[model samples]
Structure formats: C-alpha cells, structure tokens
Target: MKPKAPNVHEDGLLEYLEDIIGYKEKQNQLKDKLSERKKNMLKQNKITKILKINMENLLKIIRIATIFRGERTIRFDEQDLIDLKEELSRLERFLEIEENELKAIQESLKDMR
Candidate 1:
C-alpha cells in the first residue's frame, strides 16, 4: 500500500488549538495580575484613609489646645510652634503624594477596562 499524505485540515486544526491554549494562558496571567493590583490599591486606600484621619485629628487637637485654654495656659514657644508647623507641612506633602499615586492607579485601572 502507498504511504498516506498528511492532511492539511488536521494540521490547521492543531495550530488553531495551540493558539487557543496560548491565548487562555495569557488571559489567566492577566487576570492574576489584575487581582494583585486591586489588592494593592485597596491597601493604598486604607493607608490614605488613616493618614487623612490622623491629619484631621492632629489639626483638631492643635486648635483645641491653642484656642481653648481655660485655666492653665499651655505654653508653646516659638520654636515649638515652628517645629509643629514643619511637621504638619511634611505630613501634608506625604498625603498629597500618596493621593496622587492612588489617583493615577485608579485612572490606569479605568483605562484597562
């Protein structure tokens, strides 16, 4: 009996199956990465929330101490006030940076959709 020739349709079908498998693998990898990114974003959000609350509380305490001195006057010297102002400025800068980073991440996620 003569040798049989290879079938072109069978070869095409095998190639198509391999492509499908590759596509699915890539899709799964992307899905995992997206999940990780979302988790990271959630962590960042929590950090940002904590920072905001701390800043607000710090401001409130400063106001209450400085403005609402009733019996015993609290003495905050010039240097002390200056140091507190500097610390507040540092916190503000840090919060701004974190907020901008989070906003960029959110925008990128939106774009991916």
Candidate 2:
C-alpha cells in the first residue's frame, strides 16, 4: 500500500515552524545590534574618563604656570616651560577631537534609548 500523504494539520504545523524560525532570525539580528551599541557606549565612557583626568592635570599645570610667572626670585627655566607648553597644546587638540566624538556617540545612544 502507498504511504499516506501529509495531512492538513501536519502542513499547518510545518508552516508554524517556519514562521517561528523566521522570528528567531529577526530576534538575533536585533540582539546583535543592541550588543554593538552597548560596546560603543562603553568606549565612549572610557574616553570621557580619560579626558577628565587629563583635563584636571592640564588645569593644574596652568595654575602653577600662572603662580610662578609672578615670582621674580624663582629662576624658572624658559626651555622647560616651552616644552611643557608644547606638550599641553598637543594634548588640548587631542582632547578637543575626543570630546566631539564622545558627543556624537552620546547623541546616537540617546536616539537609541
């Protein structure tokens, strides 16, 4: 005898299984996007922390320079001051770029929320 063909209930079950598989694929794609967003946010946070620490150091250096500038008795080396100024200038430029990038990342994160 020939085997029975698939019944209507069996066909319905197969269609439901295919739909569930499609839903799972969509769910995985969403999960991956969320994970990438979280990683980007973490990187932004790290950049902010680093920027804060460096900014504090720069401010302290500025204050010291201002204080020492008024002291006539102290023989501060001009060369050392120039070197420090150059280094500080470089750091300031780097910080400026980092701040802008962090701001953009923050805006994107806000939109996602």
Cα lDDT, all candidates: 0.61, 0.60
Q: Residue 63 of candidate 2: its Cα lDDT?
A: 62
Off by over 4 Å in 1: 1-21, 68-113
TM-score per model over all chains: 0.48, 0.47
TM-score of 2: 0.47
Candidate 1 total steric clashes = 0
Error of 1 at 102 (Å): 10
Task: In model 2, state the lDDT of residue 101.
Answer: 64
- What does candidate 2's lDDT look like per residue over 1-113, in tens digits? 11332665444654566567785576566666656766665676666567666656765675677687775333354445556566656666665676666566667656644
TM-score, candidate 1, is 0.48
Report the error of model 1 at residue 99, Å.
11
Worst 10 residues of 2 by lDDT: 1-10
